[model samples]
Structure formats: structure tokens, C-alpha cells
Target: MISDTAEYALRAVVWLVQTPDESQTTRQIAEGTRTPLDYQSKVLQLLAKSGITKSQRGTGGGIRLNVSPDGLTVLDVINAVDPIQRIHSCPLGLKEHGTCLCPMHRGLNDAVKTVEAAFKNTLVADLLKTRSKSVPLGIDLPLRAPRKPKQATA
Candidate 1:
């Protein structure tokens, strides 16, 4: 199973894809994805470090997706925050077991592999095209505040 951080990262990525043209602050992303602001901030930092997203400072600056949604995979987002750890050897470190895993452990590892493959194949753009009525995170919240109209020049 994916970690909560991974789930939050996926939600954040999906939200970003929805508003591809604009950069979003951490607060905006957190509100849109319904994630905790502080936690989301950390997740975004990890993503930026991983090259999945980019951050900018100063006016009109914020975080934005670095990779195209069409090219970005679910695994890319999940791995950016919490990497899926594969069990290669016995978790108990049994001398006899060595690289061989017990039946239960092998099963668990196989499940993890299947999930990883699926995530790797799924693009962020595909999630947005889901047939289900609910959007990612079921978030209907606006990602940005309404902009004020420009005043007439004197």
C-alpha cells in the first residue's frame, strides 16, 4: 500500500495538471487537494527536489509541474515523496533465508511490484480523464482566488 505522503503527492500532481497554465502556491495546492498545508509543503519540497515539480520565488512565483502531465506517471509523483520499497531479501535477516523470502513475504513483495508497475504505466493526464464523477481527492474547491479586475487608467 502507498503511504499517505504518496497519496497526497498524487493528489497534488493531479491538481496541478488540472491547472496546467498557472503556478500555484503551497497553500493553494493544499486547499485544492484537501491536504494539510504543512504536510503538503513538505511533499512539494520533495517533489521539487526530485525534479517532478519546480519552485520559484519573488512576485508571480510559486510551484509548478516541471514535467508534462502526459509524460508524468503516477509512480513519478509517488516516488518523489515516498518511494515504494521492494523486499528483495528476508526482512527478518534470517541467515538461512538469505535472498529467499518466505511465502507471506514473497506474496507481499509481489503485490508491491504489481502496484508499482501499474503506477508507472499510469500518466497524470489519464487520472484527470477518469470516467468517475469524483475528481481526484474529490476536490471541487477553486485552486486560485478570483482576480480583481483592472482599474481604468486616469
Candidate 2:
């Protein structure tokens, strides 16, 4: 299973691409996408560290995609952040001595391959364009102002 942080990172990248505005700070990115500010902030940092997204510090500092969305595949982001090893190695982490997928992971291999293929084929830009129709699993909210926090802790 993919971590929510990884999912949010992918969403952030797509949202950033759909309507780019220079570079978006963590707050701005989370606010517009209606995601948790703190969680989004952490994901941004991870993305920056992975080289999929770049970040600047202090004033005028924000985040942006390192590569053009059109040129970046979903798998690239997935591998960079929350890579799902495709299981070709081994479910039991066995040494390289199998003729094919072990019986325990036979059908699973095909599923993993299908998922890998889908991720490999999907480009960020391509996914963003589908916004008007269906929302991606990673992002559930529409672009808009983030909900304002309560003035008092009460």
C-alpha cells in the first residue's frame, strides 16, 4: 500500500502543473488543494529531497516540478518517493534462484506488472488534464481556498 504522503506528493505535483504560478510555497500548495497544511508541507520536503520537486527557502521560496509534467511519468515519481519494487525480486526476499514467479506470488506478479505499466504510461500532464471529469485517487478536493482555521483553540 502506498503512503498518504506519497499520494499527496503526486497530487501536489499535478495541481502545480494544471495551473502553474511561478513556484508555490508549501502553504499555498496545500491551501489551494484543500490538503492538510502540515502533511502537505512534509510531502513537499520529501519530493524536494527526491529531486522530483525543487524547493527554495525564505522569501520567494517555494516548490516546483523539476521536470516538465508532460515528460514525467507517474512511475518516476512513485519510484522516486514510495517505490513499490514490482516484486520481481521475491515476496519472501529469496535469493535469485527462481525459474519464474513463485507459486505464492504467481498471480501477484501479473498484477504488479499491470500497475507498473499503468504508472509508466501515465504522465503528470496527461493526468492533470482529466481534472474536469474524474478526480484522481491521490487528490480529492477541487482547487479553491483552504478552509480557514478557527480563531480560538476552544
Candidate 3:
């Protein structure tokens, strides 16, 4: 499973790709991606450190994507925040298991590897090209009110 930080990073990157020519403030990116402002700021900082984004201060200055969306992959964004952890040894610390994982662990690790590979192959720009009716970040959709929970009958 991906961490919230990683998810936020992905959202930030995808959002940036939407307007590659414009520089967006942390607040704007956070609001656009539905991520927390403070958390989004930290995530952007990490991304900038990783050379995935560039930040400028003062008038008309903000954060922008440093790398091209065509060249940037989903794994690149995730790794900038929290790299996918691979199982290298026994998580349970079973002396018998050691470096060789059990069947269950091996299967889980394999599944993770599959996910990692998929992400590595997926470009951030590809998310914008989806033919689905729903758009990523809902940029093209009208805002909708949150649904209220149904009240139980007495």
C-alpha cells in the first residue's frame, strides 16, 4: 500500500502536469489536489530536493515541475516522497526464514514488485490521457456537495 505522503506527491505531480507552463503556490496545489496545505508543502519540498520540482520565492514566484511529465513516471513521484519498500529479509525475524522468504511473504513481495514495475512504466502524463469520463483531480468536472449519511429509522 502507498503512504498518504506518496499519494499526495503523486497528486501534486499530476496537478503540475496539468498546467506545466504555470507556477502554482503550495496553497493552490494543495487545494487543487485536495491535500493538506502544510503536508503538501513538505511533500513539494521533498520533490524539489529530488530535482523533480523547482521552487522560486518572492513576487510571481512559486513551485513548478522541473522534469517533463513525459519523462517523469509515477514511481518517480512516489520515490521522491516515500520509496516503495521491498522485502529483503524475513519481516517476522524467524531464524529459519533468514533471507529466503516464506511462501506467503514471497507472494506478497512478488505482488509489490508487480506494482512497482507498473508504476515505473507509467508516465505522469499518461494519467491525463485516460479515456475515462472522470478526470484526474476532477479539473474538468463541476464541484459537487459531499453526500450526507442516511439517518436510521426509529
- The candidate scoring highest on lDDT is 3
Candidate 3 lDDT by residue in tens digits, 22-116: 68999999999999999999999999999999989999789888887777899999999999999999999999999999999999999999999
Better of 1 and 3 by TM-score: 3
- Sorted by lDDT (best first), the order is 3, 1, 2
Candidate with best TM-score: 3
The TM-score obtained by model 1 is: 0.86
lDDT of each: 0.83, 0.71, 0.86
* lDDT score, candidate 1, position 83: 91
Residue pairs whose backbone atoms clash in candidate 3 = none
Ranking of candidates on TM-score, top first:
3, 1, 2
- Native-structure RMSD, model 3: 13.5
Model 3 — which ten-residue stretch has the worst lDDT?
A: 141-150
Among all windows of 10 consecutive residues in model 1, the one with the lowest summed lDDT is 141-150
Superposed by TM-score, candidate 3 places the C-alpha of residue 92 at a distance from the truth, in angstroms, of: 1.5
Query: Residue 149 in model 2: shift from native, Å?
Result: 34
lDDT of 1 by residue, 1-154 (tens): 7898999898888777666567899999999888999999999999999988888898998988777777788998888898999999999999989998999899999999999999999987777666567766775533332233248899
| Winner by lDDT between candidate 3 and candidate 2 | 3
